[model samples]
Target: MSERKPRKDAARNRAAVLAAADELFARRTSPEDEVTMADIAAAAGVGKGTLFRAFGDRTGLIHALYEARVEPIRNAVEEGPPPLGPATPPLQRLPALLDAILCFKLDNRHLALALEGTGSDSPYQAGHYDRWHALLQAVLEQIPGLTDSDFTAHVLLAATRADLVEHLVGQRRLPPEGLRAQLASFTTKVLGSPALPGSPAEQIHS
Candidate 1:
């Protein structure tokens, strides 16, 4: 009974922390750099020690929150319907997956940025990134005559990186729809889809 009580309390505290962190990221207007573990701890109504113990550090907390928020997309790609699910054709699913990722970053801009900011070389170091990359590589392998699925997956995922998203949407203020269109076009080109009029790929082929 004593052991169970501590476990229950730990789980409850963890949930509170995640909920608080999610709310803060959702409503924050200030720079993501300004948000801190202390802020999350205060918002969660837990002591700083509990926050650190629960998450290890700010990066870990951000990762946990990111994983929580991205869970739905993961589920959709894993078992849900066409476009995102496993049943979709690789060619079709590739773009759909990338589009979903781009939209996720756009919707959770600050949180995404914060996660990326924690990395030095690239956000690819994030643990969740490995799962995405592995899934993309497997999908790429299903494409006929496609080579270097590993490298190709890396390149494709880079297009949806959080920092790039922030630059396009946050700095340049590109409309969400416009960004989605651009990514679709880019993916089409990468997958060797027939080039549309005025596309640079079309010009090169011409």
Candidate 2:
């Protein structure tokens, strides 16, 4: 019973920490004010030591929280129905994937910014960025005449960057739906839906 009790307590502590962190993130508008390990420990009714033990450090905790939030979208893209699922046509799924990303950013604005940051630093090194870039590149490759699929994917994903979305929605005051439509339209033009834009693919990301 002693061993079992510790395991149960660990599970409970993890859950409490994640819940507390979510609430804190939801309330704060800026990552600078993001919940600290001490704050999270207090809110979760645990000790700071426990929070550190569970998540390593502030960045690790943010990484966990971000991954937890993105899991549903990940699952939907990997296995769910049309537009997001693997079975959908590459052309159709491409826009749908971008739309999903935009909507995710809109829905989890604070957390998204916290995870990816609002800085001008390149996020290409992040794991999520790599996953998205690879998936998008694979899809673009399947579309005939769409050369330089890799570069195209990166540029396309850039259109939905966390900071970009925040700027468009928070500062520029563009409606979320309107931003989405513009992205879809921009994407359609690039993909040669009705027809590809005259600009060459190599110059796209540059």
Candidate 3:
């Protein structure tokens, strides 16, 4: 008989391994107490060798998890709602993008925490920061009469980051809707633009 192909079960096993690793990493309170290859393999009902074959090692697994979770957000910023168009005013586009980005952070808090946990020294951290900075710069380039547009863009990006939002919402127990509104107002003020009329709170809650 011809050699039988690996069954669908093998594919399931690989997915389970990655999922388990991601969960463990996200929940880990400290790097020292983080999950091991054996822990992930056992959780996924696979052998250590199988896990290794799939992801090489723990660092590889972490990298995979980071990419899997972050790529979607990056794609959304690039192509999703509030479509980028030359006709769209920067004042209009800026608030919409800010809302979209804050919504993403609210939804993906755990994944963001995991990515940020890698520290500023990590390659992944640097790449993420650079990507965000570029996105902010693109948005700012459309605005008029800014003396230090680039610096202002960087500040805006930092204010909207997941970690800062989580600190505001999760720790401070501020309503996400209210927080977004406050942020949108503050952002417009900092950029020397008039606040968008009507409370973003109503739109957020609705």
The C-alpha lDDT values of all candidates are 0.84, 0.80, 0.67
Best by lDDT: 1
Q: Among all windows of ten consecutive residues in candidate 3, which has the lowest summed lDDT?
A: 80-89
Off by over 4 Å in 2: 118-121, 195-206
* lDDT string, candidate 2, 146-182, tens digits: 8999899989999988888878887789998789778
Using all chains and alpha carbons, the TM-scores for the candidates as numbered come to: 0.88, 0.88, 0.71
Candidate 2 global TM-score: 0.88
- What does candidate 3's lDDT look like per residue over 1-206, in tens digits? 23334656667777798788767756654335657788888887889998788778765676677677667656655665433333446776666666756776676565555555555544236456666667667778777776666787777777777668778877788998788878788877877887766544443334
Q: By summed lDDT, which 10 consecutive residues of candidate 1 come out lowest?
A: 196-205
Report residue 12 deviation for candidate 2 (angstroms): 0.9
Candidate 1 runs further than 4 Å off: 30-32, 194-206
lDDT of candidate 1 at residue 81, scale 0 to 100: 78
